[model samples]
Target chain A: MAETGQILNLRRYRQLRNAVVVWLTLVVLGAFLLRIPRIHILEHTARNLYFHVPMWFTLMAAALVSAYHSLRYLQSGDPIRDLRAREAARVGIFFGLLGLATGIVWARFTWYLGTSLWWNFDPKQSFVVIQLLIYGAYFVLRSAVEDPEKRGRVAAVYNLFAVVTMPFLLYVLPRQMESLHPGAEGSPAFSDITHPIMRLVFYPAVIGFIGLFWVLYTQRVRLALLEQRVEMLQATMLEAKS
Target chain B: MKTWLRGFWAIFEKDIKLELRARYAINMLLLFALGALVVMAFAVGPTPLSARVQAALLWTVLLFAAAVGLGRAFISEEERGTILLLQLNLRPGAVYAGKLLVNFVLLLALNIVAVGAFAVLLRVQVAWPGLLALTLLLGSVGLAGATTLLSALIARAAGGRGALLPVLLFPVLVPLLLSAVEATRSALLVAEGWATAADELLTLTGFGGAVITAAVLLFDYIWLD
Candidate 1:
């Protein structure tokens, strides 16, 4: 057991240490590329090309993970899958909020003044908020139940249901309704206006953000499993002492 | 075939009998629907009722009232521990079908009351009663399927209050709501023909069928847990 633990710890440290260096290098490169003065001619809105788009990519990745775990939980009836689903949900909520925040910031820079309300009742915005509220309620519902099996089952079911609605809320409704947000019909970048150079950074930004979300989700899942193990150990110790 | 139909009717009858004796769920729903319509009338005070606004008002009333009814439907069963008894006596499919039947009836009632209130208070005209009824039927099926599944989900959760119920339900109901609103708006518009609204109606029906199929398949899994 000791040898296995040492090996796992060494593996985690080695992988994560190298990953951090690579991530930092990319960040530095991205910053340098973004800082060139001529790039400002692309319009202040172009700043969103890096931040807002990546946040959306992260949101979609997290939601997909949540859905995957939900399906696993249903099929296996395992508490671990439920935990993964919950972690994915939490991470998805964070990215969803980040998307909203960054979109708002971009909106302020390009369209609205600083004094404008942070949230408008735009269909996409409303739908995303509704999605967040649903998952927020999922977490609240899980904590409220004391029985682990019931908590896992109910949260898994709710997560599945929420996942089913996300596409409609995020894509269908916005496309139907008139909206100020870009990309109702196609990619966010306009074909006519977007320089090929922008796509170079933009595509990588999406990939990097999705990668970051995966890392966070993995860490969260591990933390949740550890918490469960600790709780089980504590209960066992109490039983033995008694 | 006869046995299956009998089983479905028996489940439906059982729910109706229970509600009839208690008079809790239906009464509360009707009263809530009426009250919401009254409030909405006041809110929209003296403004000329455009067909779109009237359709929106009617939907708002029905949605909120159905939320109240849906939350109460399983909650009363849970509080009385009747769900376990019912589970032991009937198959999950039968129970689902019956609960859905009761919910369909309840929503239909609320829809009737909402339409009446809209006509009386807002002076909105319904151009095609047949088309409108068909639209409501399709919309109610979707509503009942989603509500039944959600009620079962929340019935097991902690703090499964009125708060958690709508929070869990509204997201799932968005497509239904959108389709229903579009169909209802089109039906109310004198200039727009039924052909124009056919796509929305079809979408609502498709969604309703999908939700019902999902609920039936998934209920057994949920029931065991």
Candidate 2:
């Protein structure tokens, strides 16, 4: 009973740790909000800095995590790694959709309504949508397969292939199309105009979003593993009773 | 290396012979190409063959024709359950090369036919045959690589063996399509030299090489399952 209580305390400590992280994030975000207006050139676009760019960073981190887990799964044949891969993919897709939505909103404010162009067919937008569809197909493929091993193998293989397209779709295709997404060649991010002060906050924003993604991904993997454990335990109980 | 090439040639010959015997894939592709051209004619309707319209029509026909042709490439294998048999016999590299070769040849033929039809129907003049031929070669390689990879990906999914191929393929193929259209357009307009279309052609070749390398590396893993 004492040992059980200690294990319970450890779990509670982890939960508290997560809550503390969330609280700290909220406080930092509040500070970021206060700092945005003073940045002069970034006044109107400042709102996008908090939402759009962080989501893109988070999406990339999630995708890379998914790829890492996929490679590990292929090497080890471990179901836990497969679960991690699936969870990362699911989180990656969520952030991907968020990035698209936020981008459209930003575009509406900056380009569509303001510049009077309803649709530009920007290469970044198109490629991101394609990335979403490919992963969406990944999930559909997963659900369609009944055999667990085959599902894992197939999903891992597909994930490997799909990730290879990322560099082309994200970087090469957009640059070749001469996109307006900023930071391709002469965007402010790469230029001297990127104030030293802006990098200070931007770096933290990236780190904070990645941390948030990690929290969500770890929680999801735990839930999945717990569910699998319950299923296995129930099967064992049934076998013994039989 | 010799064994791999032999396996590749064997599979290539088998697909070619099978395709030749039935003529289903080519026939359907040709019919589809002609029908698309007719539809395009009606759509563009004697619009004086402006450079933009001519380029757009040529690419549309080629894109749709390749889509149709690629969709059928794996259908026979799936139907006859020969994909498994072939997979057991040949290395994944050989399978990829053989399939790509067949698709490349078919796309080359289809491009020729589509380009000829566009020249006649759309009244688009080809100024530099050599530059245009180079563009077609690079563009077709990209198309073949992308389509082959996508067809393999979609082959295993339920009902995906048909519709999902185009859905996954079209978005990625945009760069190639854009480059091909621009290069062909510049060539038609008698742009001073290859300099105008060089950037687009280089982009296509770079993308194609990357995709082919990736497909070759990943195909074995994908096939193992």
Q: Best-fitting candidate, measured by TM-score?
A: 1
**Worst ten-residue run, lDDT, model 1 chain A?**
A1-10
Which candidate number maximizes DockQ? 1
What is candidate 2's lDDT per residue for A152-190, written digit by digit as tens? 866777777677656655544664465665666546543
What is the C-alpha lDDT profile of model 2 across B1-225, one tens digit per residue?
998999999989999999999998888888889889978888877779777668877887888788767776666677778888878888989988999999999988888888788788877778888888998999899889988876775565443456556656665676677777778878888654498888878877887897798789767765666
Which CAPRI tier for candidate 2? acceptable
Q: Which runs in model 2 stand beyond 4 Å of their true positions?
A: A1-20, A23-28, A31-33, A37-45, A111-113, A170-182, A185-187, A194-199, A231-242, B156-160
Reference-based lDDT, each prediction: 0.75, 0.76
Which tens-of-lDDT digit does each residue in A1-242 have in candidate 1? 23334423646755865785587467547745664334443354575667676776777677788889888888987677887788888998998999888777666655555557665566766776777888887887787678888778777777776666555455447645766656555436354556666666667777767767767776777677677779999999999999
Per-residue lDDT of A121 in model 1: 60
- The segments of candidate 1 whose C-alpha lies over 4 angstroms from its true place after superposition are A1-17, A24-28, A31-42, A111-126, A179-193, B1-4
C-alpha lDDT (0 to 100) for residue B126 of candidate 2: 83
